[model samples]
Target: MKFFNKTGKLAIGSRLRMLTEKITEDAANIYKLYDIELQPKWFPVFYVLSQGEAKIVTDIAKEIGHSHPSVSKIVSEMAKQGLITEKKDKADGRRNMVTLSPKGKMIAEKIKDQYADVNAAIEQLTAQTENDLWKAIEEWEFLLEQKSLLTRVGEQRKNREGSYVQIIDYIPTHREAFKNLNEQWISQWFKMEEADYKALDNPQGYILDKGGYILVALYNNQPVGVCALIKMNDPVYDYELAKMAVSPTAQGKSIGWLLGNAIIEKARSLGAGKIYLESNTILKPAVNLYHKLGFQKVGGRPSPYERSNIQMELIIKSSPFQKTAE
Candidate 1:
């Protein structure tokens, strides 16, 4: 854990540079393997046009951060390939409007499929490594965004059941079950402070008020576990995981496991790339659970919690998940 040391600045930078090269190499390999003749820069240009609504060539160039000449050349080549068509703008005839041609649309669809395949291949190669990479990126981005940004706020565990788990959302009137789970955590580890206990009790007031979501597990019509999706306004990432708890009665039954997977799936569906959480080291089961669920530990940062906490994060993607019963 050299990166965790206060003097680990060099180690951290080296690690980041290595990751960048690896990702770049991976991208190049994917394009070669797929036999995609389209250059990396053209993907964004074609993607923008495929989204409908004719766009001015200049605007497309600006949006993708490419120079006018560069984009112009690429667009011209695409037109020759019958992938796109350019027309003079009616209001400003000097400006050219770009639209995807039939061939262009087909190419766009193929690009989308190739993108999904690349992601699947990466996931298969890295497994949880993807999660760790995202967590590091989010943490670094957060630090750069806020001068007072803190890291390593808590530790979490992985879901016991593999990747797929039954998830439940919109569990109104399940406050009592969650309260019971909080009590179980307090009794088994350390008593929950009054404030922390209160936060768990009022999910709507404490969590949802901050643009978060509450989910609970049910068995035979009984509440079994609970977790929340806490929205982060930080520019680094859009959401965080908070106030996760499971009843001691349901501990060995993988209730929390399902709850964790459900939250991860929900976050991914919402277009979130990273999820952060806070927990204590004393909660060994919880720590291990987060790891199993693809969460990784990072440097500690300041937070409202009084306990010695560890922070964990999971990277999410748009991979399909099985629909759960309502």
Candidate 2:
């Protein structure tokens, strides 16, 4: 406990394992007190069989949240102790069904009272605590299911490294990176169209020289992402957010978000009132990122690329507001 206090949350796995061992040891002692000749690990299987239905090892494992091999080992131990009987399944000859033997059934009947007592004791213990451990554990499990511990740690690592990432104006050096990043993503999802080559092949002539701007995200002084604000001649929209791409390795580091905000600022500085973007619905993450940057879905826009099926626009405001999304 003192070591855990010093190490904090980093030793959570070790602490949980230690706690489980203590509980398991106490459970074994409790079974002995009940005069039940059963291993603590085999109780779940025994209880399930007591309900009068034969089950296979796979079913038992699923019901008790254990692995197939673990349940198989416990079944073998119970069989060796003459506590369970196994027979070929009538429905499937290759499969074997398991059920409690006479000795196991007798022990199950004797443990009914013990089960009630243990349930009441557990309830009393939880009621005495300031916060119910059972409910707290359920909440923790739900949160972990939403975002796994590995994903959370990966995001933290990305955020730490993100400090070294810089958003800068596009230059000749980033031309190859810009083309390759966009091409990689496009070729993975959709075929590159003539419009893609026109812009990606010559970003300066097609976008930058035409009263537009491009922003590049550099992580460790290397280009990882690119976003372009192409000048539009439409009546409602002043600029189009186009050709946004990030390297697969550099994803989840907020590079796309950084480039998006920088390009929006540049559009505002150029006296732009609205920014538009065309994207496909299949690119869910990209569409979500656009929405986080204050872009709203719109209709009635013609696209040069066949892959574009959705259009969005953002209204530029005079004062900058803090973004809430990462």
Candidate 3:
């Protein structure tokens, strides 16, 4: 398969962008077919302005759910084309009012029937889907307006779940949590090895006290996922990324990513380079996650555990947060 087509069209954001481009192209074609000399981007402002006597920029922005600066820029372009006019408000001296021009009114009148057919065509196109995307988007947008997606998740966690996950450094009390989570997975898949028991027996002495660090994910004050960064060869200190596990019951909550990134960050805080891990391919999600966090495969590192087959390493860099994630 070619590189771009390899993901089988499963890239949601890319797919959505492709769909948006198609619709935008169709819109442009419809405007051309009707001989309307206007860009699709100009339509919202133009159509909204046509319905009212005059409106201020703030009012138009609020009606369209767009930023004031965005609406202002559009208004500026429309004013340049003599499609709209700006004047001081009679009632409020500080406010500027925007009104459609005579030329714009004539154009609106000329294209009324054409725009009606365009709307009907769009409605027909959308109606073929089982779930109305327009209606789904309206609801999604409303929820987003109430609170951002992450904020809503946090709110739900606080209100409904009653507790949230916190990533914290290894403590004496977290020994059993670190042990049980690791032991459960290891024993279930491949019997717990001697090295597993040694670390689980004394995490602080074996891991934390040896220039290594453990990050544990706690939900409702109980540990859900745990990972440790082990120190090796100083000056160019390499870190062994090992013993990462998320409790099966708490699996799908992204606690593993939290623990994984936290361990990577811990390596950074310790001024280390080349964090590496060994794993079996059976753990597909874990392998994929390592890849996601910039780990590249390097075969045959002589892993201590019998289950080890795949080895990967991460060279640390600055962490950049996604806007919504932040």
Candidate 4:
């Protein structure tokens, strides 16, 4: 009957729901032993109202993370059992406010010790696990706060089904999308320094005006991927491959390859001598992609970025559309 051990790690949501049901069942048993009539399902709404304050059903639902309809049903049941009372709010006559009745308050006072004992039992269960469940739950909640579970799932789904992608040269309107995509990747991997900000925030000033090129990958007419080739100050290298990023949702669809080739071929068309790039070794996928494109590791120059741990240069042999002699 225990699902936690049987279903294994990937069934986390299932395991948590099962654990909640077991805890509710245990609390119900404790109430029975204490000679108190209470259902575990009614605990959240009742507890919120038991603080000597009247609250509307909408407020109760929000505080307890239940739907309005569910709380409404529970309030109706509590009223039928003579455990609570409902009346129109003084401030808003149309809205009903609920409060614990005298009988309900008496029951809560009688079972206060029993509730404490139930909570202590649950605390003891946490000691049985290698990691404290409360701490893990807190961390997980914080992470979900940063990026919701629904968003992460949706991004994964989009990554798998990227069918319509069009690689195009960057235009004036794509300024924001290019900046946002680059900022996301840069902030995740490393801090966005002054140089990065200057380059991204004003691409025309830092890139196109200096004879550099930018390529954008569009999915459904929205720019989801971007890469840039910036003309270098040094004579040896003509352009520095910089600010390449694909949207998390549009990734894993060879969009990187699409943007990379687009920019590289653009460099060849401009008759660039050599294309170089700088990146950190921690970005394994990006570094690997550069290697696959025939970019070779070279001696390091004094980099403006602290994240630079790898430098590469690409020697494009010839244009793809052009053939070589035997």
| lDDT values, one for every candidate | 0.74, 0.92, 0.83, 0.88
Give per-residue CA lDDT, model 2, range 229-256, as digits (tens). Answer: 9998888889999999999999878888
lDDT value for candidate 4? 0.88
Clashing pairs in 3: none
Quote model 4's TM-score: 0.52
Worst 10 residues of 4 by lDDT: 317-326
Clashes within 3 Å, all models in order: 21, 0, 0, 0
Model 4: runs farther than 4 Å from truth?
Answer: 1-8, 157-326
Clashing pairs in 2: none
Model 3 lDDT at residue 258: 75
TM-scores for all candidates: the values are 0.45, 0.73, 0.50, 0.52
Better of 2 and 3 by TM-score: 2
Tens digits of per-residue lDDT for model 1, 9-78: 5366677677778776777777787766565557778878989879987898899878889889889888
Comparison by TM-score, 1 against 2, better one:
2
Q: How do all the candidates rank in terms of lDDT, highest first?
A: 2, 4, 3, 1
TM-score of 1: 0.45
Residue-level lDDT tens digits of model 4 in 87-176: 988898999989999999998788788878878887888878798888988899899999998888777765655557889889999999
